[model samples]
Target: MTYPPQHAYPASRTPGGRCPVAPSLYGPEPDGNALPAFYEELRREYGPVAPVTVAPGVSAWLVIGHREVLHLTREEADFSHDPRRWSLLREGRVLPESPIMPLVGWRPALLYADGQQHRRMRAAVSEAIARIDGHELRRSVCATAEELIASFAARGEADLVAHYAQKLPSQVIIRLLGLDERTGQQLIWAITGTVAANADSVNASRRMGGILSELVAEKRAHPGDDLTSTLLGHPARLTDEEVLHNLAVMFLAGNHTTVNWISATLRVLLSDPAFRSSLAGGHLTVDDALDLVLWRHPPTQHFPARYATRDLVLGGRPIRAGDMLLLGLAGANQDPAILPPDGAPVVGNRSHLAFGAGPHACPAQDPARLITRTAVDTLHHRLPDLRLSVPESQLTWLRSPWSKGLESLPVRFGPRR
Candidate 1:
């Protein structure tokens, strides 16, 4: 999982120049969690378009400027979202020869596909998200948040990550998908393991895929009103395998990313006493907290890997076809060019790359935002004194290139009034 050193591009440097893009600021020494520092370094060295080699043969134009990244994202034809190319690079396989090729052989999930295929899948799922009544869902989320907060509130100690923040979104996603209680719990565990970016995560993804395959079969025989059943009823429209793929994708995409958001938001809120007071007073709404979370600590620290389908020019550099493009979302969000010149402190409502953009933008963003806002609002209102139990230095950030989140967050607070 280590990439070789490569140079990042500056607007003025030729590809064959002596100017070296800085070394990757992560990996073995830092255990791959040095993204924040890396971003800062790149910003200092290359300005808006610094070139850094993330891995061998994976030299990407790290678009740090907000407008630049947005422009690249909008140009789907120029920068493809195909995961196979990146998968090949990761496995060190030559073009079209990766063992995981079969996995990505078909057009990737809606997030990775292009043209009509991507549009059709997104359209199908859009209805489900649009049909969801956010107000009702928010009420349910608040009720769940209260119940969870109350459970540990009496104990005066809890791991916010494991017991509260992580659980809230899983439960919400389960309800949204209309899964049964037992199935929901299993899916939550499976999805969490799958997204953690470890051997366990890989195994969990496969197991979840198998389980989804079986569920697809069962749904076909006995259709219901659930999302799974809806996919089943559309047999001619979507094959069983495609349904399973989308469902598996949904589980991984929806569960972990949202969990990270919840944890990071809580971390930021608890770390700042003033912000906590503002939250307690209702001066800052859940929406406010969410905006702050995205700006301050995006769920995923790095952008998902992208590939160039052909030779193209970006940020004043020529990138060849099949070149791996690492769109540094975290880097883009923090770019000074996008934010106000005075550099206003991180707060909610700042436009960011947390959910990505363009044809492949996350479709579940609305529901995810609604769920997060509701959860935060509920917790603040129900447990005003909730605060961290452990010192900030003792906390451990999850070590993964895929998501930026904590391994745990212990908190204690007075019992609900």
Candidate 2:
């Protein structure tokens, strides 16, 4: 699966007239897991904008500076959310089946639209999401969290990643979408397979599309009081295709990112003594820990990013038209200029690029935080004695190009009393 050296697709030249080799940003390489350090290295070597390859021969820039990332994501006029602007994909250099395609590939969803069209598409989603009852959503998250924890409480030991963090969000989202349990199970399967971007990614993606299409059709006819029905009836006048894709966006974005956020936050809570003591001693809140994780272990590491709409200079790197730019969310949060002089976590700052910023910024941040907070609070309330089952060193990170998540968070706690 290797390709020629990254120097083959360099964005700029070195002082010696040779192009600097862009490092690979994919695969199970060491950087895939220890991304914060990897990002630091990239920054040291290439400043704010570093050239990197995503898939084999798929070259792009990884924006690592805090300000640069802000500009890249915020200035939609200069960069586009539309993947059709991607030069490599447009010219057929990137294979259709490349694992990254499921993420960066275009759909009719607002996630890929721009300007007026983006505003139109986003209004429907934002309104639909807003229509959700906040108290009810919190209750569902608490009940789901308790139910999930109860399933594993008596076991004394469990992999929280699978048994709790992973299930709670999917189940809650299923309920929000008014999906039957069977359909919900299919949704979970399709989401996991597609986002994991394995050999079956393309097929899994198609399956997800089918599932969303059916849900849209069913909701259109029945028009329940669920999120799907809300989208269908929205005043934005979204077409069936628009509603389908937006629901897909909502479902996909809500589930996986929340899963990672919960898992990573729990990892920090379990492993870091200072965090635990701070929470226990009332110096910090669950919200603080969640914000810290957002900064330090952003759910997605390098976000699938904007395409240069026209030639431009960014962070002093000459970005040609149609060039891809991966938003280094974790890297930007770690930017030296933004950190304290002593390099400590900025406990209360909620301005990190974890959910990104600007028009296409994640519209579900509050819901995600609510879900994650309720899940963490419920688990600890039920099992105050919870502790890691394995040594911290034994925990493994999921080698996802996009996500920063533990593969599992095995823990031991007292049996239900």
**Top candidate when judged by TM-score against the true structure:** 2
Lowest summed lDDT window (length 10), candidate 1 = 94-103
The whole-model lDDT of each prediction reads 0.67, 0.83
Question: Which window of 10 residues has the lowest lDDT sum in candidate 2?
Answer: 1-10
lDDT tens string, model 1, 123-194? 766665676777888888888898888778777778988888888888877766667778878877777765
Off by over 4 Å in 1: 1-35, 47-61, 85-108, 234-236, 281-283, 346-350, 415-417
Report, for all candidates in order, the number of backbone clashes: 5, 0
Q: For model 2, how does the per-residue alpha-carbon lDDT over 1-417 read when each residue is reduced to its tens digit?
A: 111233323346421123545677666664324676788788777778888877655678888889899888788889899999888787887788887788789989898899999999888888888888999999998888877877878789999888988899999999889899999999899888887856887888889989989998998889898989988898888999988888887877789999999888888888889988999899998899889889888888888879988766777677777888889898899899889999777988988999988888999888989999999888877888889988887887665567657788899988884
Instruction: Mark the regions of model 2 whose C-alpha exceeds 4 Å error after superposition.
Output: 1-21, 31-33
For each candidate, give its TM-score against the true structure.
Answer: 0.84, 0.94
Model 1 per-residue lDDT at 271: 90
